[model samples]
Target: MDIDVFAATHAQEWKRLDELVRRRRSLAGEEVDELVDLYQRVSTHLSVVRSAGQDPNLVARLSALVARARSAVTGAHSSSWSEVSGFFTRTFPGTLYRLRWWWIGASAGTLLVAFLAGAWVVLDPEVLNAMQTPEAMRQYVEHDFANYYAENPGTSFSAQVWTNNAWVAAQAIVFGVFLALPTIAVLAMNGAGIGSSAGMMIVHGRGEEFFSLILPHGFLELTAVFVAGGVGLKLGWTIIEPGDRPRLRALGEEARAAMAVALGLVVVLFVSGLVEGLVTGNMVRGRIATPVGLGIGFFVEVLFLAYVYTVGKRAYRKGETGDIRNTPEAVPVAG
Candidate 1:
């Protein structure tokens, strides 16, 4: 649709949204929130129209509404404060959290690889030797892992770059593809890497020690990685096969949800590291103790992942019932 035509039709709704913003004093918190949401939807639609092709008329209409809204917020309408709060609390934060999932995965993936490589040195040289060699392990231990971690304390900034690069490359192989094979491949690779490392530790005498060393941090770190991978997979698939909607459009929709998953992953990994470095770091206990700690951590991690990723409450469905938005169908919207 032409931007102008679309804007003209939606002008009244936009106006109402503006009025709500302007008349914040007369409105309740919930009412202001509702209007704000409607306004966002209209704005998104306008964006869509503009992207399709510029319509001077539509641009003019949207520009006017944006100005009005901005004015209301900046003007004497003190109510904008709460609305702003509401936006961050109810809308913007959620959007960001959704974006975080991809970020978290990307971050976690790099960190996990780094951590494993580091662990390869001091934690289990035998496993490292089996996987690569003593020479490789020595290089990683003395140079790679030590240098990397020493330079990158938090791991947030670096992890993001790696994740973004991976996503960008993956996106090419999958043009807005949804649940593409590549996404699954990424997930599987991560899972395998994790499982293999853990399994190898178990096979060697270090297995018991490994859990204690990693459990404190691994609990959150591993779960976050899996979640991030899941979301990334979802994004890839969404891009590959964007059922009903155009691929790009569907990818956008999927991205919002996938990103949320990634954000959660970031929180997990960062916190996990603290636990590893602080709680588990000082305790130089026995092998049995380490494995016991690891076992407990693993159990908790699995349970939490199951609840969050697999068996959680779902959104509602269309036609078949009421409030499907609360069901699986609406899960992404909430994300």
Candidate 2:
């Protein structure tokens, strides 16, 4: 292409694209549409110039304009608050609601395993004895279990629990790509710990103390864990059954969706941490602080469930898949 001829022909379009980028904040709806159209045309014009034009100045000018125009075209449509609102309403809860069966399965399977372990230990003297010496078991039940909660300052303990549970939730999502083996192991390991602890405490007649401390935070904390494990397992299962979508595409979609859960769980686990640190460890004079903490956790959980059922149902019905909106270049992907 002759450089001057091409520049002359496309000068008007480039100027319009530049104007749109500059005034993107004040654009009327049709002007915004025109801006996007001009952006595409300018992108094509830049490609043509790079391929055929030898003039460095012309290529550099078009290149800069295209970059600015592309940024304005895409950036104008999104805001930080919009992203947060979208995740809570559609991405996070919709994913949770849509994948409810998997989490329900996780919850049932985990509790069942824990119940069996506790029962086995309680029913058989040999099982509990083989796990630990009587003296050690007594120490753990009467002192260690309860002391563990109060050993640290409340603020420190809350931060510790928050970070630890958040990390576990994240690992559940990231390790999900490996066929969910890691996630299953994590869930089972947690279940066994809880069951063994309960069994020992009950056998030693400290069962009330055990629950008083655990229930305050464990209700919501464990629920978050089960959800994380569920999402991970679901993502892994996408490998076995990609449905109508391509394998990689399905995996990518599920991975992105699971990440939204991971982010949301940070907030959920933080609440659990507050319960553990402030209420389970520290008690009011009436000895009902722990119960109140449990109630708080239960309330938060119910509120979340209500949001998921109401908002998430609507989002899922509207076909929000929980994946981040793709870039312009990715529009051709089937997912």
Q: Which candidate is the best by lDDT?
A: 2
Judge candidate 2 at residue 157 and give its lDDT: 93
RMSD per model, one decimal: 10.4, 8.7
The global Cα lDDT (0 to 1) of model 2 is: 0.81
Candidate 2 similarity to native, TM-score: 0.77
TM-score to native of every candidate shown: 0.47, 0.77
List ranges where model 2 is wrong by over 4 Å.
Answer: 1-71, 284-290, 326-335
The digit string of per-residue lDDT tens for model 1 on 245-282 reads: 65554655565444443443444455555444434433
Off by over 4 Å in 1: 2-130, 134-182, 284-335
What does candidate 2's lDDT look like per residue over 1-335, in tens digits? Answer: 47688799889988888988899999999999999999888777766654552554565577678777877887844568997988888888888888888988988988988998888888999999999888887788777888888889888999999999999888877778899999899888888888988988888888887787788788889989999999989988988887876576577668778988899999989988987888787752234565676687678778777888899889988887776443222212111
